[model samples]
Target: MINANKTLSLAIMSGKGGVGKTNLSLNLSYALNTGGNSLLLMDCDLGLANLDVLLGISPESNMQDLLTSGAKPSDIVIPIEQGKKFDILPAASGVPELVEMDEDMQDLLFSKITELVGGYQYLVLDLGAGINGTVLSFAAMTQMRIVVITPEPTSLTDSYALIKVLHSQHNVSDFNIVVNQATNEKEARETFNRLNMACEKFLNIKLKNMGYVRYDPAVTEAVRRQIPFIKYAPKSEASRDILNIAVKIQKIRMENMGRLSERPVMKKFPTLDD
Candidate 1:
């Protein structure tokens, strides 16, 4: 069991839009939560929030309600598989305004979120594609930023653009990459090598490999069913790979925090001392 205080925030990003970023986010979260730490998978894709669809849950209230109105985090939080222990806070309900949150609003949300962070060990923020002002700001703010990409040249090119913005604009050197939709292990390694080489040559940033997920038909079927691949096909190839990724992330977290006793857990609102 995780201690009920510490929190870790991970922003899940992608170079291109349809590279299975949400799939990886949700499944890895489920895997991590299985290890005893409470997980809050925040759908940070403000404009096109579909994390709920992926989890097969339609949220009644989301972050948008809290941001536009004066709703508290607890009021908007939707419990997914309540007894299972992991929860998700969907983005604003209904059509997204896409108005671009102002600096004042950003500051207000950040302050409130800090209080909410105390309830969970990990807050996995699934950011949208492209390096817009908002995405870059959130990426720079987080302790860890994961850039997801496929093996396509176009995908790698866009990823470079993202890494450039992060380095030049945010001065963020902490980056990790996960190769999705790879044909096999060899393809995944080659893809990581291509991107890793470029970052070293031009940006002077060394990217860490967080492992890869092979292309699996079960993943597509799970999407069709509007459920996480991990839950839909626990014995499938992708599910096994997701379990590995989860283990790797847990190891990295332990290494970063220098603690192996237990992970952190988010608790009830207002009761958090930190």
Candidate 2:
């Protein structure tokens, strides 16, 4: 289904690697796609992309192909299935220069993205770690930004650092936090609250608690089996948590749309009641 005015681009980011960024992106995209929303899960990790690996397919060409050869967005799209839900998009292989694509290439990337967005309700960009050019650019370009962090002290500190970088470099004030790999609901809530507190106190920015994912062995098994954990173990804790996260995201988008609908439009009176 094509929608010219309904695309919501969300960039998934992390302060550091090994924080389950790719896994969250995959599962969340799958869960969001469940309600008949056209989703495009792009591996904007640029160099060292692995979303395709999680989905169990190696594309002949990826984002690099579209960037260099003028390939259409549809040319490299790959489908992924998580039980009954699915989405499609181009993956990024370990291309050395993509992490630092030049301004010309960046413009081309955005142009291609515009073409792809016409058909997707949501475009989930799975970005790489840190505040490098790649991650920062994706975060800046996307309409929604979700930062993934765990309960570890280092993770919290680095997440703050990431927020500081985005605010300083890109002027991105709004952010959402996802507490990944939490042990329990209480732990997740506490972790998210602490981070939100820190952001409010220090950065003067309000960070929304997007949702959390519980730690589960099925995550590793799914990685080993080259499938999303939600599909690999639907009844697992992680899968259920991801489903809940998706619901929260849906509600947020719906609320945002509702607010837009409430806006007053300036109407022009007909000249002569034609």
Candidate 3:
């Protein structure tokens, strides 16, 4: 199907690396892919791909095959966990820079993905850190963009820089913020407020607080075991926080589906109409 837009495309991205963006993406995927919801978790960090390592699954085809051999999205996509309900499109093998790559190829790749993902209910993209043309382009197409940050000053600054670029360059008005590795709810809220304050004061953008994941040792253990923390430690503090975030995501999913239903024919690629 061409230009199908049935999926609630959500990008779980960050301003910088080492903020547990990939781990969040994995757990979030597991949390949301319940109650008959079919989901696709894509590792859009082609440069420094690690979702495969996080999941401890080796796919036969990745983005490298998609870009180099013109592999279809359907061909490259694999189940996030074998015998499981959700799916994931592994990252490319080599660091293929989007700016360096041909625009036509980039268009074709995303266009194919947009077309292919329509069969699923949700598309969760774990995009690369920083502000680049490739990352921005992918970010612009999703229905929801969640910027995962931390309690660090550098994380806040870099995330703001990312928010600035997307707002100024792409006219992206809305962004969802998730403060990962927070010690407590107060700290998470304060971290979010600092970033939101900067956006409101400078960019005139009001950010959404999607909630935060508490710092938990279970997270480190889960990473070592190459498993989603939510599955590894269902009762852990971080898992509870992520599950709460999943609730907010489900609420938005309903709203997004409603919006899609209004259109006569869903477009191939969807953007923030909110």
Q: What lDDT score belongs to each candidate, Candidate 1 first?
A: 0.79, 0.78, 0.82
Candidate 3 residue-wise lDDT, 1-274, digit = tens: 3333557878878889899999999899999885468888888887778898988877887887887787888888887656555888888656656434555766777767766677778778898898877788778767778999999999999999999998888778889999999999999999999999999999999999999999999999999999889889999999899999999988887867767554312232455464
TM-score of every model? 0.90, 0.89, 0.92
Error of 2 at 239 (Å): 0.9
RMSD to native for every prediction? 5.1, 6.7, 2.3
Worst 10 residues of 1 by lDDT: 265-274
C-alpha lDDT of candidate 2 relative to the true structure: 0.78
Best by TM-score: 3
What digit string (tens of lDDT, one per residue) describes model 2 on residues 87-161? 556556657899887767777787766756656667788888888886777687666788999999888988999
Clashing pairs in 3: 3-268
Which structure among the candidates has the greatest lDDT? Answer: 3
Off by over 4 Å in 3: 1-4, 82-84, 98-102, 262-274
Clashes of each: 5, 0, 1
On TM-score, the stronger of 1 and 2 is 1
